[model samples]
Every structure is written in C-alpha cells, then in structure tokens.
Target: MFKIEVAKMSILFSPITIGGVSLKNRIVMSPMGMNACKAEDGKVTNWHKIHYPSRAVGQVGLIMVEATAVSLDGRTDPDDLGIWEDGQISGLKELVDMVHEQGAKIGIQLCHGGRKSKIPGKIMAPSAIPYDENSIVPEAMTEEEMYEVIAAFKESARRAKQAGFDVLELHAAHGYLINQFLSPLSNKRGDKYGGNLENRYQFLKEVIHEIHKVWDGALFVRISATDYHPEGCSIDDYIVYGSMMKEQGVHFIDCSSGWIVPPNFSERPGPGYQVPFASQMKKEVQIPTGAVGLITSGLQAEKILVEGHADLIFIGQELLRDPYWPKRAAKELNVSIDAPPSYEYIWNK
Candidate 1:
C-alpha cells in the first residue's frame, strides 16, 4: 500500500519569534488610530474591549493596539488612547488581559503627534513648518522640550510593561514627531538634531535609548521607509536607518511609507506595495521587518513570507472590515487555525 503525506501549512500561519517573544503565527494587526477611547480622556473604553479581543478570537497571532500617545499633548485627536499617565494603566491592563485570554499577544505603538496633533493646542516638531497650508506652523522643539518628549516615551514604556504588553512599538512613521526629525523634507534644523542624516537620526536614537532603560520586552520601530518626494528619505536611507535601529537593540522594523510630508508624486498602492521596503531592510540591514500597506489576502501574505520579502504580515483596514480575517485567511490558504472553543463548532461546520 502507498501512503501520501500532506504538505505543511503556509508560512503565513507558522510560528515565529522576535525579541525573545514567541508568537503563535506571523500575522500582526497593524496599529491604526481608532479614536475610540473613553470620553476623550485618553482612556480605553468598551469599544476597545470588543474591537481587540475579537481579532484574537478570530486567530490573529498578534494585535498591535492603535497609536497611543505618550503625552497628553502628543495625542493626534481628543479621543486617542494614551499611555502617558499611571491612571490609564488599569484600563489598558484590562484590555491586555482580554487579548491574552484569547491567545493573542498585544503590543502598543507609542507615539507623539507633533505637528499632526489636532487637539487645539500648539504642536511640536523638529522644524517650524506646517504640514500643509491649512495647518498651523508648529513650534520647533527646543533642546529642553526634546528631552521632555524622550522622557515621556521612557515613562510610557514603563507604563506599558505595567499594563502587561508583550511588545512595544515606537511610532516613528507617518510624519509624526520622530518622522519629522527623520525626513529631510520636514526637518530643516542646522544643529546636531538635523542637517545630515546622522544628525537627523539622533532624536530617534535618543528616544530609543531612553525607552531601552525601561522596556525589556520586544521593541519594534515603525518607520516611514520612504517619503515619495525627492527631498525625503529614500530606500537606501532607510537601510542605514534600519541598521541604526538594529544597533539600538530594536527587534523589528515595521516597514511603511509616505506622510513625512505630502508627496509630490501620487502613489498607486496595491497588494504588497510596501513589501519591497521590508525586503530591502531585511536584506541590507540584516534585521527582521514587518510589512504593512495594502496587503489584503492570506495567499498574498504567504507569498511574501515564502519569498523572504518580510518576516511578519501586518494587516490593517482589512482586519477592521472582518475581525475574523485570520480565520478566513486560514481557510483560504488551506491551513487550520485554532478558534475560540465556543466558535469551534461554527468554524468546523
């Protein structure tokens, strides 16, 4: 009698580890601003309670909660979640416990809105430029103010640990404060915090240095790998940035693009449009990368992993559209994913 052996599952559904943390699979829900916190006080609400754990129940390996402000003034909007104060810890801890109970790991993206803040106050930036004609010119951060923001990140990291997060991501992307320092199009300082690329990297390097003092868990940096303008950071520049981050003990580079300033050229985004950024970072910088941007299907995600383009697949808007995207992806990819005990019967049938 002849026997046939079945092929193993897709790498998209395979387990991988980063920064000493083990995830059951490689699917990471990208951090998107939800603006759903309680009463605009920067606290998690029941909306988060339902929003996050449902993805875990749907079998997403990891869920990165939205970009959370590291300081009250750092918030992008009034309703954004925050980690700036101790009072917010209990609410976050409750959410963490819920995600963990559903067998998913959780991470929080620590951010400062900088010039992008819409909370009716003076925003801060590396330079005093407005993001657009409609926006106000932000105060270029003084040396003292820069130190304060760095300290805020460190304190927030400590609060995240207290809240029991498995990972912490620094939001250095999408034209935020850190991205403002990173991109030439936005940062025009002549000091050590700007001018050359090394100087431009100093702010983020210092921020990470301070965060390292408190965060011992998985540390990831989400970066806008390109600004899509001639004056902005290029892929080659990100290779250098990725290397610097790796030296700082960063475990993963979440590859994304644009928003450093408005692009001169239009972006024609489609499936895996940003995977090349991740692939280049992994190849040249020798660090793991999480690919985000327009990646929508499990088969597409699987191909990316199989081809060594990226180490993790970050699903964004798609996850919001269908909380069970992971389980559905499993079915589409002809792999099996463990569902919640209560949902097993439904999935099985």
Candidate 2:
C-alpha cells in the first residue's frame, strides 16, 4: 500500500496569476490596518518592517498594503499612508523594493473614503448621509469636484507604479466612495451620479477607466457584494457591476461585505463567513476573485482553492497573528514554499 503525504502535495503549492503578476502560491496576505504610521504625519514608520516585509519573508504569494489614500483629504485617518505627495513616493518605493527582495509580489490598495472621509477635519461623501449625527455630515461634492477626485485617483496610480508597486487595487468597498454610491441606503441624490444602480455605478466606471489610463499593471476593485440592508444594494446589482468592471479590465474583485450599514450592534463573526460573496461573484462574473474575512486555517484555505470558490484566499487577522502563516500553512498542507536563507537552521532542525 502507498501512503500519500499531504504536507508535500503540489496542489496548494501551485502558482497563480493575479492581474499582470504571477503569485508563488494561492495563499495571500490580506491588507490589515495598522493605523501605525508616524504620529499625525503620513510618514511610513518602523512598523512597516514587522507589518509587511515579515509576511513576505514567510513566502506569502501576494501582499496588499492596507488601504492607502489617493489624496490627503481622502484619508480615513491621519496615520494612513498617502500617494498624493511627491515626497511620499520614496517611502513606498523602499517598501515595495523590500517585499520584492523577499521573492514575494507587493501591491497597494489605492483608496478614497469619499463622504466617509475623515482625518483632522470632517467626513465628506457624495451626499450627506451622516454616518452618525455627532459625526460631521459630508458636504456634497460638485460635478467639477468629482472630476478632481477622479484625477486624484489616476495620479495615485501613476505614483504607485512609479514607486514600483506590482499591482493596483481601487478600494471601493466597506462603505467607501464607490460602495457609498452603490448603496441606496446611503447615497441620495437627484443628479446623474445617484438614483438607480447604473447612475451610482457610473462614478466607479469613470474612476477605473482613468486609473487604467496611467496604470499599465494589474487593476482590481474591491466591492461589497451585498450591502446587507433591506433597501440597499443587492447581489443582482453586483452581478451587473461585476460584469461591467470586468469589461473595464478589472482583473478581479476583492469580495467583502456588510460595512455599508452594520448588521446589528453585536456582530459576532465566524470563520469563512464571507466566502459566499466571493464564491457567488466568481460563479457569476466568471472573473478571478479573492475571498476575505475570517479564513483561519490551512485546511480551510486549501479547501477554498481546491473547491474553485476563489482564485486567491486573503487572510487578515490570521496573518497578523502569525507572520509565518504561509510557511506554517505549507508545512501543515505538505507543500514546499521556499523559505528565507536566514531560516536554514529551521529546516535542518
């Protein structure tokens, strides 16, 4: 009788293509917020060491930096990284270079928080739907101002590419600008940018189209599949938007859900909870998609890959809890991931 060792299997060890870049494996490091930039300034700090390159050294296939602002005013916090300034490029260039030196690909999630925008001042959105009454209501952005925001996103992409990022993702999820517009539960307007799903989706189309103008790399949009509100955006709406996004050359969608409006006061999450959204999008749009949210085990991660649920699996808290998650996952699943030369002692041990 022959015994098969799962630890050395090649199934999970396979390389995959994300946009224009090739990943060493299907396991990915999901972007998790550190809120740890240099205090009150958008400077990259020492935290970037343990926060990013550590995961890359562990042989994670692809690493996405936490949502980085495309504009100063678009930032959710003063601590968030920004690409709007020429001075910021050097820091990002260094980070991207470090990740590449480790044999892993690095990407940046370019973002604009829109009306939900926050920092030292107030939150701003397409329309003023107060996130909270005490929270400042966003002033409506005029059409001319809308174009400037779009230009800002394009500039951010150009800077990211210049800074050596391998991929670019438009952060359109979690009730940010794009998702805010998509949700009937949030955006209320009489203009062309609001009303129906098509109108709401128009702003995103323009943004992606323009970003693609200067960015010749892999392009992606992160979208909330279901707004999870009774009168909000639905899966059907996502199908249409997903199809359109694919046409605009969006290589994949980082499928996540439920931040438009909180489901309940107490939202206890379970493992692989949001897999369904990614799975559904993969089935319908027929485009490569990544699944995120509470995917916590090697077996579960492998299952998502094996079952055709998603093209890639993104784990946030799991990676934070263990920077060597990819290495550990490889060992548990019997796959070989090239470990850093400095760790030769471990292999012999």
Candidate 3:
C-alpha cells in the first residue's frame, strides 16, 4: 500500500462543487444494486435504510443509491427499488433523510432494464434482440412507447426532487434501455430512433431534457464507455455523447465500461483500468468525470485526481468490504477527517 508523508496533503479529501451542490470531499460511494427489496413491490425496504446511512456514518462524501427502476416494467430485477409511483416517494424520502442526517449527500440512479430485465412478461427494447443466446428476445418499442418511457423518467425525476435527493443520475450504461438505443449492435431501428449515431442518441437526449424540466439539482449520467466489439461504440463515440450531455447541462459523467454484452475478458482488469475513459472524457469533452472500477486505495484515487484524470473517485466493492473506507483512506494519505460524534474519542485520537 502507498502512503503519503505527514507533511503533505491529499487532494482526495478536498471539496468541490458540481451544479451548485458542494460535496464534503472528492470521494463518492458508487451505486451498486443489492436487489434487497424482499417484497418485490419496487418500494424501499429496511435494507436500503440501513445500507446507505452506514456509509454516511463512515464519512463517504456522497452516497449514490443503486439502480432504481423508473417504471414497473423497466426493473432489472423483481426486487429492485422503484420510483415509478407516488406511493414509493415516502419510503425514498426516509432513505434520503437518513443519509442526510449522517452528513452525506445522497443520489439515486434512475434506470430502465430494457431487454435485460429478469421480470416476466414481454420486455421492450429499441430492437427485437436478446442480450445473448440464453436471454429472451425483447419486442421492438414503438415511437409511442418511447414517449411513454420518457414521461416515466420525467415523473421519476419529480419524485426524486420531492424525496429531497441532492443528485439524480440517469443510468445509460450496462446495455440497459438507453444503452440498447445507443449501441448500433442492438438498436436496429430504421426510423428516427436508430440507424445512425445521431438517431441512436435521441432517446437519451430526450430523457435528459425531460428530467431537466422537473429536476434543477445536480444531474449525472453513467455510461458504458466501450462495448468491447469492433462494431460497437468506442471512446470516440462517447466523446461525442459526452459533449452532447455537457450541452444539456449534465454535471458529471460517471465513466464505466463494458457489460454492453456478455463478459469476454481478454485479460484480468487491473486497478484504474477504466480511469483512462474518465480522463479522456474530462479532457476532450471538458466535463467533470468520476473514475470507477477497481480503484481501491487512497494513493491510487489521489494519483488519478492529482494527474487530472478524473474529478471524483467513485468507490464500489471496496466500500462494501469496509464502510469506514474513507477513514482508512485518510490514514493512508496522512490526512485527518472528522468522525461521527459517537466515535470522537477513538477517531480523534
């Protein structure tokens, strides 16, 4: 493990503002779906209430909730959290309040599963395609259906605002609904929604536009930077998409790659393997970016920020292994951070 001397400071502990919201530090708890809503009714559960606030108590700067379905049919799993109806707002509000009480800002990732949904019944996508040979083929969405999905997103944004969320993220990655539309490999539509880059981008563009109408807070987008196929989207394509998102007032691009299809890893990924994608977007598109994937240590995260590769450090599985990761990171970097009041004696020492 790398460590900094006591005389030096760590940039990872610094504060930065995006879209008028100031974070306590540069560390963010990346969203990871737990699928813990045991009732399977798309409502927040006891697990969500405990899971998110624990990170806040651990001192993470920002906590991003898992992929929440924007519509009932859009859920990736039967038990995923939802923001579809007004009834779900109260539960979400409770989760948000709990996180805020512990001094951490919370955000939610609004998502649609498209063809990848594990729920029963007919699923929809830009084309009648299956994610893989074992996956069921989804029906092609009509223009009217697309408009309905957009409306669902808009309504979900309104619900997010009502629930007092500090940030809202549209999940456009991981071969989901918006991703299926963006990727030429899955989006075979001949009409306005497909066939070319501009056409493919229309679905996400409209989702952002509609969400902005209701949400004035920080807006973020998580995207799959590459498809790992020669015929699929590459870094060059995301540069264009990143520029478009910037134009639409997106605050940050959460850069994550692959999973647009089944795993075909040529080699095992190393730490910061996906940092290059965030770095490229930050430099080329000139928008704030969050680097994720295998970033585990304070030194590694700090180096990425110090080199101007990304604006934020998004931690996933690491935070799960240790909720007090920020505290651990502070020690590694020779910095001090305020601990929760109850733990003052131990932490302050």
Candidate 4:
C-alpha cells in the first residue's frame, strides 16, 4: 500500500521516516532567525506563537526553529531565541505545543555564536581570530571553556526534549562557534582542538556525544559545507565529516555554505546552487542530507528529491516571503493538500 501510494504521489508529497519519526511530506521550513522574540533574556514571545503555527497550518513536514543560543553570551544578537536555562522551558514548550496542534513536527536548532556573537561580552572561539579585521578579536577557549560549551549543548538538548520538540539540530554552520572550530581560517590554535580536521571536528563530535546522553530524537547538524576560501572547509571536508556524523547517528546533514570568513569564491545564485553539496554528501557518506539555498518552487524541490540529490528540501527565504508557499507548491505540483477545518470553505467554493 505504501509503495503504491508513493508511486502515485509526487515525491515532494511523499512520507519519509527519519530516526523513528515519520514526516508527512518532504518540505521543511528551514530555520531562519526571527529577531522577534521580544524578551532579550531568551524567551519565546507572541510573535513566535503566531509565526510558527501559520507554517504548520500550511503543511510543512518539518519546521526547524531559528538558531537558538545555548548560552546568553552565545547569542548572535540579543534577539535570538535561547534554551540555556530551565526557566525558558515553559515558553518553548508552549511554542512546541502550538506547532504540534497544527500537525507539524517541529525541531529546534541549538547554537552558540562564538566569535560571531555581537553581545558585549567575552566571545569564545577555537582560536583568537576575528571573523574580519573590523570584527572583535575573540578569546581562544581554554580547555575548560571548551568543556563548558559542550556541557551547554547537552543541557540545551535536555531543555529541548522537555519542551517536546520532535527533533534537535545543532547549528555547527555559518561562521558561528562550531563552524569557527571547523574552519582552519578561523582556528589557528596549536591545541588538540585545532590543526587537523580531526581536531577541528572534535568540538562538534563531543557536542553530539553530550547531546545524545540527554536526547534521543531525530538529530541533525547544519554545516557550512564550504568556506568558499582556500584552506577552508570544502565539500570534500564535509563528506568526511558527514560520514563521521553518520557514524555518530546523525540523521541528516543540512548542507549550507559560506560566511566562515570573507568568501573568496562567488557563484551566481540560482536554483539549487548548494544541491551538489547535499548530493555529494549523500553519495559519499551514504547518509541522508538536506539541500538548502534558493530552493523556492515545487518542481525544483521535486526534482531534487526525485534525482536522489537530497532526502529533504529546506525552504528558507521563500517561506518568509510567503508563509503559504507549501499550499502554492501543492497546487503547482498538482498534489492535493488539505486545509484545516476552519478553512475548509475552499471546498464549498
């Protein structure tokens, strides 16, 4: 029955199971930080309550929450969401409940901004390198500081679980903390946390290990597959990292690129510029992967999944432009999507 149903459906509307949780479709609302969380102390607000549920009603299979800092000092900006404290759990749980009420599986992205943090505090990084000449010089993390960040990830995962999230993703991408460690350009340390790729990856690997101790849901890691500069992390580097993550039981690699340092390379942005990264990771690592970056239409998403380039399609800015993009996508793909009971008057028309 399942095989026959899938055969008759557009691949984008097909169901997929990831680490014991099954999604209703392949469309994922990629995590985009909305600086609307009003309280600067890292709490969900009325804006989030309205924002997330609207997308769930549009029928996205999964909705990954914005980059939520694991510590107050780790915020990319003062407005980013946070799960660092037990006090924040109530508001987060409410956010999760609201999304679940609309029948969408929601996940939260746990992160630490590291050198990318704009807060007025001591910033942490694998080494004391600044992102750019104008950026603040970050303090090189002591061995003790490294362990503190790892513990923070673990504790945040615990909070996410308690808040009833269906999935947990570690934000190891962009020019953020974990990405700072992953790229040699940002990390010029001589310790065990620097030098070789193995050392660079150790921070994230240990973070995953700690998160695993507290949470057992679908796990994902968003990575900057390429730093777009020489001697920086490349797709080839991610292939190796993807396999290691697969071995660590990560369900998927959310393949995004650049922003580690000033990008040296430029590609004309079009549909699926980063799909190759996802395809390469899936092909080489034999792990499920998500393709993000400028994926805006149903046919484009369908093509990526059909060609086996990626298991999930992450729609970011497009969704911000239109919260009902999934509904429009279903119409474009000629796939039927049901509206909630309150909006069932479309059938009467």
Candidate that would win on TM-score: 3
lDDT of 4 at 53: 89
In the range 100-139, model 2's lDDT, one tens digit per residue, is: 9999898899888876666766466778786655567788
Q: What is the C-alpha RMSD of each candidate to the true structure, in Å?
A: 3.4, 2.8, 1.2, 3.2
Model 4 lDDT tens row, 218-281: 9999999998887788899888888889999899899999998876655576778999999999
Residue 304, model 4, lDDT: 84
Best by lDDT: 3
Over the stretch 241-294, how does candidate 1's per-residue lDDT look in tens digits? 899999999999999988877756554676778999999999999999999888
Model 3 is weakest, by summed lDDT over 10 consecutive residues, at: 1-10
Could you estimate the TM-score for every candidate?
0.97, 0.94, 0.98, 0.96
* C-alpha positional error of residue 122 in candidate 1 after TM-score superposition, expressed in Å: 1.7
Which portions of model 1 miss their true places by more than 4 Å? 1-6, 38-40, 264-267
lDDT winner between 1 and 2, please give it: 1
**What's the distance in Å from true for residue 292, model 4?**
0.5
Of the pair 2 and 3, which is ahead by lDDT? 3
